[model samples]
Target: MDRRRLLTTAVLGGAAGLVGATALGSLSPEDVWAAEGANAKINPGDPDPNFVEGRVTAVSDAVVFVTSSDGTYHSIRVTTGTSIWKLNPSTLDEVKVGDGLYARGVRMPDNTLAADSLWVNIVNLNAHVDSIGRGHLNLDHHGQRVVAHVEQGRSAAVYNNTPAVSDMSMLQAGKHVKVIGAWHPDTNEITISTVYAAV
Candidate 1:
């Protein structure tokens, strides 16, 4: 794997053989942004060909089967190099049927995605900051109120394309922002991973 994939897989991908989570040195928001950026580069105008977003329907020892929201079937192969993230670093054993999954990897000749990174129950939203509390932010996402909980010491903010920081005091109400988080299935809530906004 390259340095970018290593860092991302190490940070978001669980700590195990191939590239352990400790290899990244820290679970900083930078890694999260970088990983997402990498995936975004796949297709500028078209859909990402190397990404899969769907619900897991079946899991075997080394492969996961998914059915996307559009009913497209995907077969993903998991290897030692694959990194699993479920709110945090996790193992393949943690993957279960019905879990939401977002995977990025190489598309194989056989049509199976050779997954390098897996984010289970992850969510990305564009919303306006409705309110900011001691440990959470209320957002108006597509006219729906969403409660986003901030994880102390884990959540970070990137203001105006600047470096990521833990200081969220700069966030203002009514500002439009992008949020990357882990979703609590079937709820209007999420645990924030990173918040991107303009100062």
Candidate 2:
């Protein structure tokens, strides 16, 4: 198996057995969402928090393991409940293995980082198009290729309302564009929020 597939399987297996009933305990769904939102925004500059800054060491189908500059390693498991979105879709492909990452989550006893949200920092990208398809666009920025999925709508009204691929004609292969969206590592897809041609 390829390295990506192997990593994904290992993490998912660990999460299934270790997470257990902990996610079902005292926190209500609303409480959990609120906590997750709060956790998602925590950063190192904060006065007091449980947030950690690290670099992605490995990305598996179900987990992303990160190591901090201080030499601490964290095993972050992604689940159906995990929220993965990009601040910029056109630039999402800019993230790489050695790139820096900031994550926030409730800590586990084993010192693994059980992140509620994973944010890909895009400050390093020079911005360019990698490839484009009939219903998809691949962006090459920094050292990664971010793929954005687009689908046609039934009518103009429907097309206007659909965020996935509203303006298909505006996107062209090899054209410089910007995108913003979310990433789903489980399926290896990115749901784009917006697509823009580079000025």
* Cα lDDT listed for each candidate: 0.79, 0.49
Top candidate, metric TM-score: 1
Query: Least accurate stretch of 10 residues (summed lDDT) in model 2?
Result: 154-163
**Cα lDDT tens digits for candidate 1, 23-81:** 43333334655656553665466778788999999998788999999899999877666
Q: Give the residue spans of candidate 2 off by over 4 A.
A: 1-49, 88-96, 122-199
Cα lDDT tens digits for candidate 2, 17-110: 3332223232222223335445345465553234566777788755677787788877776543334333431122344576556655555556
lDDT score, candidate 1: 0.79
What is candidate 2's local distance difference test score?
0.49
- TM-score against truth, every candidate: 0.72, 0.36
Give the TM-score (vs. native) of candidate 2.
0.36
Q: List the pairs of residues colliding in candidate 1.
A: none
